[model samples]
Target: MVSHDPAPADPLSLHGVVPPTVTAFHDDESLDEETTAAHARFVVDRGVHGVFPLGTNGEFPLLSDDERDRVVEAVVDEVGGEVPVIAGVGAPSTHRTIARAEHAASVGADGIVVVTPYYYPLDGRAALDHYRAVADAVSLPLYIYHIPSKTGNELSLSTLSELAAIDAVAGVKDSSKNVPWLAQAIDGHPELTFLAGSDSLVFTGLEIGCSGAVSAVANAFPELVVDCYEAYADGDEERARELQSTMFEVRDAFKAGGAYMSGVKTALRLREFDAGPLRSPLRLKDEEATAELRDRLESIDDLEW
Candidate 1:
């Protein structure tokens, strides 16, 4: 196993609104590189601190290896170094995960977002070892992705601390949504950075020392999300809370739909972005639901694409 310790040079700390990009698909659900690159550039142009492609919000699991590489390359080339692009590089298998990480590095990704190995339950030691192997395999900075609800394996605080000690493990995306644990993680490792994995928790996360969030809601409303962070950063608690409350309606609307990717795609289409639809087995939101989403968004006039 690789040793976890501070690297000789600390990687860039993840801060502000980093939207986990949604993959653009054609009507037949084939990868749409042009639309994908356009969406990526759209977010960057709207002023998010960074763009994270192929994350859970990006439907990472649905994408094949080649598709993943193409999307990452498209985003990298489009952004052209305007902002950091952290490519998702997680797989149920360690070797495959490492290969994805290496690919991200080779393609000039700023960093990698790696989730704990899923499909099998893993204890702390196993989790530690898995991440260590991946970290050892690549030299680029890594942000540990901890979403226990989806993976069925929670990254305990001890595991996070252990990973934080790794030279290449720069930070973590704590999707736990457990506020107490988030606070504990922040207090325990003041030196390590954390990004909230949920939209509802972004403000609270920042209040408790988390750097920022990789928000799903940011995909639909980039400006509002960025405003919340800027408001909190400037210590305008009331304004931040107000903006956050407005986003709650949209966030809840996303949850009401069976699958959020479809809702997001529909919303993008509503905005004339042509994000297409979700792949098989994931149906688009019903017309009624899409109408509700449109109504909810209409109230928030400041929201940008």
Candidate 2:
């Protein structure tokens, strides 16, 4: 297994709580660059280790090409030096993913997270060639985003091993939520940095040797996840487990009334941070559901929000 020592020259060596930050929009649903940048700054200020824009939580697929580039630019401009900005540049097509990755690199992103090409069933060879082309398109480190649940495409172990062999393919963000699969992948490829892509699996992923997490929950409660990660990193396993339980509590509370996608933004608004509304087809929980969410959150003695 690779040592946990920091690799100054390797962007994939990034660890700790990296929030897949939410993209902000005005009431009219227009991009709000100022609020978007502000959210990045807020997370960094709260001691998050890195910032990721244009991921599932960021509503990447809902955005246009120009808007995607703008989000990366806004985030990088706001917190590029403060923390690594690993922008999500994946698309359903190889060339499109490459274009987005190139744009992210140009805007000063530290690395790129490429979700598997979705909507089409891809065999191993197609997946391999797609990633290879995208990796070759830019000098930035490439991280495979494995969220088969949404993409309807899963990378087999053999395929993951092959992807790990690419010089530019540096890591993975696993939202598969399959512990066995993640464990085997991490064991088979120690050289590649592994990040837990789900808030529900952050601690479990760390237990299996993930370097860190790309948490959706961290978008609103960065410090909560950060504290959990730090507890583990500091060799306080008991504390880490306690924090993990707290994280699950928050996760459950957020998911109350089916607020999975809209919870983070709503939490941000409740905390007085402007995380504007989610785009079409994804609306906030209704008032009754939201009130239940608020009550649940307030019941958590440790969480200030």
Q: What TM-score goes with each of the models?
A: 0.94, 0.96
Off by over 4 Å in 1: 1-10, 301-305
lDDT of each residue in 202-266, candidate 1, tens digit only = 77887787788888877877888999988887878888888888778777767665676676777
lDDT of 2 by residue, 254-300 (tens): 89887587788888877899777899878877788879888988988
Candidate 1 residue-wise lDDT at 75:
90
lDDT scores in order: 0.82, 0.87
Identify the runs in model 2 with alpha carbons over 4 angstroms from their true place.
1-9
Error of 2 at 153 (Å): 0.6
For model 1, what is the alpha-carbon lDDT of residue 241?
A: 83
